[model samples]
Target chain A: MPGSFVPAVVSRRRYQILGIIALAALVGAELLGLSASPPDRDMGHLQKIMYVHVPAAWSAFLAFFVVFIGSVLYLWKREERYDLLAAAAAEVALVLTALTLALGSIWGRPTWGVWWTWDPRLTTTAILLVMTVGYLALRSFVDEPDRRARWSAAVGILASLNVLVVYKSVQWWRTLHQVQSSPSTVDPAYALGLRLNALAFLLVLVYFILLRYRAARLERLVEAQAEARELAQGEELHV
Target chain B: MTPGSRRRLVLAGGAIVVLCGFGFLLYGGIGENLVYFLTPSELLARGERAYDTPVRLGGQVLPGSVRWDAEALDLRFRLTDGTQTLVVRSTGAPPQMFREGIGVVVEGRYREGGVFESTNLMVKHSNEYRPPAPGERPQDLYRTLLGEERS
Candidate 1:
C-alpha cells in the first residue's frame, strides 16, 4: 500500500492540524472581510469580492515565487526532490491563478461592464496562466527522470519570471485596469481587512502545497521501491 | 564532460536564446504597438492623426455632463482628464454603476467633430476603496473628483 511510503514531512497528525487551521482561517477571514468591512463608497458591496479575489491573485504569485526558488535549486544542485517540490507548487499555482482570473471576471462584470478586456494587466496575467500550463505539460511528457527535472526546471524558472511582468503591467502601460493597491495606497479601513485575509489565504496555500508535495514524494518512493525489487529478482535469477 | 551532458548543455543554451528573443518580442515589439487605451489629453495631442481611427479613450466622466436617453438607448457624456475633455456618444444601457466623475474607457472612433463614437463603454475603476460613511450614498463616493484628487 502507498500508506507505507508516507514521507516524514506528511505525518497524519500534522496534516490534520494544518487542515483544521486552514479551515478556521478561511472561515474567520471571510467572515471578517465580508461582515466587518463596510460597503465601499463607490463599489458598494462589490468591494467585498476583493477579500477573495485579491488574496487569490497574491497567493498565486507567491506559489509561482516558490516555483522559481525550487527550480533554481534543482538546476544548481541537480536534485530530484527540488523538481518534485517545484512541480507540486506549479499545480497549486495553476489552480490559484484560475481562481484569480475567474474572480476578476466576475467582479469586472458589475463594475467594468464587461467580463474581460485586453488591457496590459489582464493580458499579462492570462499569459502567466498559459505559461504554467506549458510547464506542467513539459514535465509530464519527458520520460527520463533526470532530463525531465532539468528541462522542467529551466521552464519553471522562466515561467515564474512572467509573474513579475504581471505585477508591473498596470504601471508600465496605459490600460483600463487600475494600478497596484497596498496598505499605503488604499484607505486604512480596507488596508487592515486585506492584510488579515491575505494571511488567511497564505495559510491555505501552504497547506495545499505541502499536501501535494507529500503525494509527489510518496509516488517517487513507490517507483524506486519497485525498481529495486525488480533488480534484486534479476540478480538472484542470474546467481 | 560526456557527449550527452554536453548536448544537454547546448540544448539548454538554445532554449535560453529562443526565450530571450521571445521576451524581446513581448515587451519590445508588441509592447510598443499595443497601446491599450489613451487619455483624452494624449489622444487629442495626436491632432489630425487621432481622427477617423478606432481608439479607446479613457478618463473620468465630467460631472453634470451625462445625458442618457433610455428610450433611444443613447448615452452621451464629456470625458475629461482635467486639462483636456472630449465628448463621447454611445448606444447601450450604461452599467449599473455608471455615474458622473468616475473613470471610464469608451471604445470606437474619434470623429472630426471631436465626438467619440463609442461602440463599447467600460468603467475604469480606481484602486482606492473606502467604506461607505454612515448614511453616505454611492453617488457621493467621491467628495471631490473635480480634477483635484489624485485617485
Candidate 2:
C-alpha cells in the first residue's frame, strides 16, 4: 500500500475561492457568448440557444472526464473519496446533459420543424444522459462505502468508455445532424469567436467541478464526525 | 467478476447494442425526411428535373413581389437569393416575420420551369443584431391590406 495516493482534504478557504472563480468564469462565458451576432439568414433569435446548449454539452463531457479519472484513482488506490467525487460529477453531468437536450429540442423545433429527431449526436447524448442517471440510481441503492465505491467506479469507467465510442460513432455514420464544425472547415472570422467561447466555457466547467468536489468532501467529513460523536455517546452510556 | 458486476456487464452490453442499433435505424429513417436546403439559384440551376420532388428553398423575400387577393384568400410572393428567384403561392397567411428581404424556407414540390408549389412557408431571420440598416424598417403592408379588406 506504499505510495498509494490518498485524497487531500480541501480547506474551507480554497473551497470559497473555487466558488468565486466559478462565478467569474460563468459571467465571462455569458458575456462572450452573447457578443456574437447569430448566424445570418436563418434560425433567427432561436440561434442564440447555441450559446447555452453547446456549453452544457461541453461541461457534461468534462464531468464525464472527471468520472473517468476518479474511477481510475479509486481502482488504483482503493480510496473512497474518489468515488464520492465521481458521484458528485455524475450528478452535475446528468443535470447539464438534460439541459443540453432540452435546449437542443427547443432550437430544433424552429429550424428542423420538429421538436425531436433521431439524429446520431442527439441519440448518443440522450443515451449518455440516461446512463449517468442510472449510475446515480445505483449509487443510492448501495449502503457499504467500500462496496459502493468499488462497484460505481467500475460503472463509471464503463460509461466513460461508451461515451467516447458514441462520439466516434456519430462521426463514422452519415446522419440527419450535420458534422461538428471545426476550425479547418469554419470561416476564420467565425472560428475565432467560437474558440474564445469554448475556452471561456471550459474555465467555468473546471471551476464548477472543483467547487462541487470540495463540497462533497466536506459533506463526507461532517457525516463521519457525526457518526463518531454517536459512537462516543454510546460508549459513555455503557461506562 | 462478482455476480452483481456480471449483471451490470450484461446490462451494459444490452445498452450498447440497443443504442447503436437504434442509431443505425435512425440514420435510415431520417434519410427520407432529410430535406436538402437550396437557394433559389440552386433550384433553378437544377432545371425541370427538380419538379415533383420535395425540396426546401431558402431565399430573401423580394420587395414588390408580394400580391394578395383578400376575397379569394390567396397570396403570392417571390423569394430571391440575389442570384435567382422563385414564386411561392399559398392560401394561408405567411408567418409574421415574412417580409421583404427576410429569408424564408419554402417546402413542397417544384414544377417545370422552376416554380415551387409550396405547402409550407417559414420565415428565417438573421441571428445577428447589427440592427436593420437605415431605410430597411419592416412594413406591415400585408396586414394593412387584410384590414382594409375586412373593413
Candidate 3:
C-alpha cells in the first residue's frame, strides 16, 4: 500500500461532512427561490433561472481554476498527485458546464424565445465543455502514466488560458451579448439575494469537488495496492 | 510522431477549438443573440396570437408614429412589418439613425394588448454604415438615397 494512504482517510471524512452541508445549503436556496418574486415589468419568471444558471457557470469557472492550479503544479514539480487532482477537477467541471448549458437553454427558451443562441456566454461555455471532454479522452487513451500526466497538464493549462479569453471576447468584440455583470453593474435591488444565493452555490461547489477528489484518491490507492501485490507474487514465483 | 511532438499537437488542437468555437459563437450572436428573427410580415402571416412567447420583431421604423415626450423623457414609436403595426415605448434617447425606415431591434415582453414594452433598444446597422471612403457614401446617405429613389 502507498504511504500516502493516511492523508487520504482524513480528507475522505472531511469531504463527506462537506457534502452533507452542501446538500442542506442547496435545499435552503431552493426554499429561498420559492419566496422570490417573479420578474418585474421587464424580465419575468426567466429571471429566476439566474439563481440556478449563474451558480453552475461560476462553479464551472472555479473547477477550471482548480484544473489550472493542479496542471501548473504537475508541470512544475513533475508530480503525479497534481495530475490526479487536475483530472478530478476537470471531471467535476465537465458536469458543471453541462448543467450550466442545460439551465441556460431552459432560461433562454422563455426570455430570448429560442432554446439556444450563439451568445458570448453560451458559446464560450460550449467550447469549454468540448475541450474538457477532449482532455479526458486523451487521458484515457494514453497508457504511459508520466506521458499522460505531462500531456494532460499542458492541455489543461491551455484550456485555462482560453477561459479568460472567452470571457473578454464579448467586450473586445462587438457582440450581441451584454457586457458582464460586474459589482457596479449589479443593481442594489437584486444584489443582496443574488449574493446570498451565489455564496450558497459556491459552498456547494467546493464541497462537491472535494468529495469527488477524495473518491478519486481512494481509487488510485486501491489500484496501487493491487499492483504492489501483483509484483510481490511475480517475485515469489521467480524465487 | 515523437511523444513530445504529439503533445504539441494536442496543445495546438485545444487552442484551435477554443478560438474557432468562440469566433463562431460571437459571429453568430453579434448585434444581439439574434438566433432567429421574425419580420413584421411573418408575424402577421403566422397570426399575432399564435405564440405567447416574447421574441424579437425586426422591421423598418414606421415613418410617422415616432413621438418623443421630451418632458417625460419617454420615447414612443411604432414598428411595422408593413402589415401589422405594434407600438414601442422606451425611456431613452433613440439611436441617431433610429429615424423613419431604419432597422432597429427592440427587446421586451409581449403584452396581450398588442404592445411590446421595450426595455432595451438596439440600432441595427449594416457594415456599409462605417466611415465612408472619402466621398463614397455621403454622411446622410439615407436622405440622398430616399430622394433619388423618389425622383
Candidate 4:
C-alpha cells in the first residue's frame, strides 16, 4: 500500500508507451510471418495461420499462468492487489483464448473440413475457455470484495490446473489436433516467423493485463473514497 | 503462519484433491475409449465388436489406393498403419489436402461387407511445414494431388 500510489502515478504517465510498443511489435510480426515465411509444401499458404493461432494460444497460456500465480499469492498473503491482478489476467486470458479458438476454427474448416470436433485437444481447450468465462461470471455475481476475492482465488487455482491437462491432451490422447510445434518440430524456415509473432503476442498480453489492472485499482480507490466520505458525513450528523 | 492463512491452505489443498479425483473419474470413465480413432489393426483386433456401431478409423492413406468420382461423390481409399491396412469408403468429397500418405480419420461403421463406411472424413495434418522448392509451387502441384490422380 505504501509504494502503490507512487507507481500508480508513474504508470498513469507512461502506460501509453506499452500500448504503442505492443502495436508496433504486432504489426511487424504479422508482416514477417505473412511475407517472409514460405508456403507449406503440403497445405501451402494455409499453414501461415499457425503464426497467429499458435501465438494466441501461447499468450493465453501465459496469462492463465499469471492468474494462477496471482491467485496463490492472494490466498497466501490476503492482499487486495493480487486479486485485482488475477482478475485482469483472467479477462485478457479469455480474450486471447477466444481468439485462438476462432483462428483454429477458421483454419480447421479449410483443412479438416469441419468447423469443430470432439477431439480431446479441442475439447479440453474448450473446457478451459468455458471455465474462464465461469470464473469471471462468479466474480461479477459476488458483492463483497473480500469474499469475492477469496472464492475466486480458490476457483482460479482449480481452473488453472486444466491448462496443463489441455497442453498434454494431444500427447496423452490420439487427437485430430497435432502435437506441439517448436523449433525442433517445425521447419527451420518457419521457426523465425513463429518466434517473432509469439514475442509480439506476449507483449500484447502484458499491455492488456497491466492496463486492466490499473483500471481496476483506480475503481477500487474511488469506491474506498466514497465510503470514507459517507462515514465522515455519518459522524458529522451524529455530532 | 497465521491461523487464517493455515485455514486457507487447507481449503486450497482440499479443493485440489477433490478436483483431481473428479478429473480421474472423468478420464477413466470416458477417456479409455477416446483414442479419437482406431488404426486399421486396432479396429481389426476388435473383430465382431467393431461392427454395426459407429467407429472412427484413422491411418495414412496408402499410395495408389485412392478412387474418386466427382459427379457421384464416391470416394474410396485404403488406410494403413504400416502393420495393417483396411478399405475406407465414403459418399462425400474428401478434403482438399487429402493426399496419399496424409493421415485421416473417417467416421462411420464397418458394415456387412469389408469396407469401413465413412460418414465424415477429417484430415489429420502433421506438424511440419515445408515450403515447396522453386520449380514446384503449391498451385502447380495442387491440381494433381486432389485424390483423383495417384501420386
Candidate 5:
C-alpha cells in the first residue's frame, strides 16, 4: 500500500524550487519598494509601509477565497483532499490577516494619531482574524478525520462569508479608515512598487499552501499505515 | 433523477436557504447596532432620540471655538458641518495634530445641554501628502530621545 502511494522525492524537489523562487521574489520586492518608490505627497516616507500592508491584505483575502472553494468542494464531493486544502488555506489566511492588522496599526499611529480605532473597516478586519483563528482551533480539537472534515468545512464556508463584510465595511458605515486604495486612487509613481510587492506576496502564498497540503497528505498516509498494522496484530492474536 | 442526485439537490437548496437567512439576520443586526458617524445636522435631524445613545460626531473644528486648559485636561470645541454646529467637551491632552479647521471624529453621546461629551477624540487629515511644515517633522518631535541615544 505504501509503495502504491506517490513517491515523496519528486514533490520535495518541486517544493524546494518553489521555496527558492518565493524567497528571491520577496527579496527583490523589498529592494524595489524600499528604494525605487518615491515618497507620497501626503504620507511621505510613512507611505512605504503600504507595500507590505496592502499586499498582505490582498494575500489574506485570496487565502480565504481558497478556503471557501475548498470547503464547498469538500461538502459536495466528500473528499479528504479538499478538507486538507481548506485547513491549509485557513492557517495561511490567519497569519496573513494578523500581519495585515499589525502593519495597518503601525501605519495608523503616524497618520491617524491613534494605534487603533473602532472604525468599521478596522473592526471587521479584526473580527475576520479572530474568526479564522477559531476555525483553525476547531480543526485541532476533533480527532476523527471524517468528523473534523465535515465540521470544519461548514465553519470555513460560513466564516469566509465575513470576508465580504470586511471588504464592504468602509462603504457600509462611516469609518476613519480610508476606503480601499487602488491604482486609480494611488499616484502613478507608487503603482509599480505596489504591484511588484503584490506579485511577490502571491508567489509566497502559493509556495506555502503547496507545502502545507503536501505535509497534510504525508501525515494522513502515515496514520493509515499505523492503523493497518494495528489491525494486522489483532488478526494474528485471534489466530 | 436518481435518488442520490435528488438528495444532493435538496441538501444544496437547504444550505442556500440557511445561509441566506443568516445573511439577512446579520445585516439587520449591523444596521441597528452600528453607531454611524453623523454631522451635527444629521444628529439633530434624529431629534430627541439621538440623545444619550452612543454616536460618532464628525466634522471640522470651528475656528476660534477651541478652548483648552492644559493643567485641567479639559478641552472644549465646537464641531461644524457648515450648516450646523455642536459643542463638544472632552477631557484629555488634545492629540499633537489637533487644530482648528481640521476634521475630527468624536465618539460619545449628546447630552441635554447640546454638548457632545466625547470619550475619545480622533484627529483626521486629508490623504493628500504635503511636506511637513518647518519644525513639525516627526524626527524633531523625537529629538530628545535621539539626543539621549547619541550621547
Candidate 6:
C-alpha cells in the first residue's frame, strides 16, 4: 500500500516540465551568447564556440562527479537505487563528454589550426571518453544484477578519478590546448555569456539525469515483475 | 565492536588501499610521460642529454629568419627566447597563424647537426586579447594593386 501511494507517472510529469524549462533557458542562453558576448580580439567570431564547448565540458565533469558519489554510496551501502543512479549519471556524462569533444574539435580547427592534436589535455580527455565507454559496456555484459552493480560501481569510481587528471593535464604537461579559463582570466564582456550558458547547461544536466534515473528504475521494476510472474506461473503448473 | 562497525572498518580500509594504489600509479605515469616545453637555452642547458630525445621547443619566431619553400613543403626558421636562438627545420607548410615575432611550439628531436628537426609545429596564442599592432598585420606583406593606385 505504501509503495503504491504515489504513482510513477506523476514524477515523470515533473521531469517533463523541468525539461521544457531547461530547453527554453538553453535557447535564451544561445541568444545571449550570440548577441551579448564581445568577440575576442585575436580569434574574432571563432571564440563564440566557447559558449557551448565550455558549458558542455563543465556539465560532463559535473555528471561524472555525480557518478563518483553514486558509486561510492552504492559500494558502501549495497543499495540498488544508488547503483541505478550511478548508471544513469554515467550515461548522461558520456553523452555530454562526446558533445564536448565534438564542439572542441570544431573550435580547434579555426583557433588551434588543427582538428585534433595529441596535446596532454586532449589526450587525457580522450582517454576519459574511452574509459567511460568501457564502463558502460562492462555494465551491459554482466547479467546478474548484483554482480553488475558491484563491478560497474568500481569501474565508475576509477573512471571518475581520471577526470581529475584531465582537468590538470594542461598544467602538468606541455599542451596546445589553452589553459583553464576563469573569470579572472576571461574578459568581463564575455564572462556574462559564458556564465549564463553554464547555468543553462547545469539545468539541462539535472533534468536529463533525473529522467534517466527514473527510466532505469522503471526498467528494474518491470524486470522484477516479469520474474515474479514467471515464478508464479511455474508454481501454478506444479499445482 | 559490533559486526556492522567491523564491516564498515574493513570496507574503509579496502577503499584506502585501492585509492593509494591508484594514486601511486597515476603519479608514476604522469612523472614519466609529462613532456615539458622548454626554450632553446633550457634545452641546451641539459647538455648532451637533450640530444635525440623528443621535446617541445617553445619560443618566438625570430623576425627576418623565416624561409618557406611552398613547392617543396619545406619550412626553416630561427626560434628565439630573447636570450638564445635555435634553428628549426620542418617538412610541412607552416600554419596559417604562423608569423614572425609570434610564439610557436615545435615538437621533435634535436639532431647532431645543430638543427631542431620538427615533425609538428603549433602556433601559440597568448591568453590576453590584444589586437595586432600597427605594421604587424600579415596583409601588409602583400604588394596590393589597390595600394599602388593610392600611392
Off by over 4 Å in 4: A1-7, A11-13, B1-30, B133-135, B139-142, B145-151
| Model with the higher DockQ, candidate 1 or 2 | 1
Among all candidates shown, the one with the greatest TM-score: 4
Residues A59-110, model 1: lDDT tens digits:
9999999999999999998877788899999999999999999999999998
TM, every model: 0.86, 0.60, 0.64, 0.88, 0.78, 0.80
TM-score of chain A of 1: 0.93
Better-scoring candidate (TM-score), 2 or 5: 5
- lDDT, residue A123, candidate 3: 63
True contacts kept of 5: 0.18
**Looking at candidate 5, what is the lDDT of residue A7?**
37
Residue A194, model 4, lDDT: 90
Q: Clashes in model 6: which pairs?
A: none
lDDT of 5 by residue, B1-151 (tens): 7776566446545544555555554577666776558999999999999899988899998988888765667889999999999999999765555677778898899998989999988877554433455556533322322234323
Model 6, position A24: C-alpha lDDT score: 95
RMSD of each: 5.6, 7.8, 14.2, 5.1, 6.8, 6.9
Higher-scoring candidate on lDDT, 3 or 4: 4
Fraction of the native A-B contacts that model 3 recovers: 0.01
Clashing pairs in 4: none
Question: What TM-score does candidate 1 reach?
Answer: 0.86
Candidate 2 vs 6: which has more TM-score:
6
Q: What C-alpha lDDT do the candidate models reach, one value each?
A: 0.83, 0.66, 0.67, 0.83, 0.79, 0.79
RMSD of 6: 6.9
Name the best candidate (by DockQ).
1
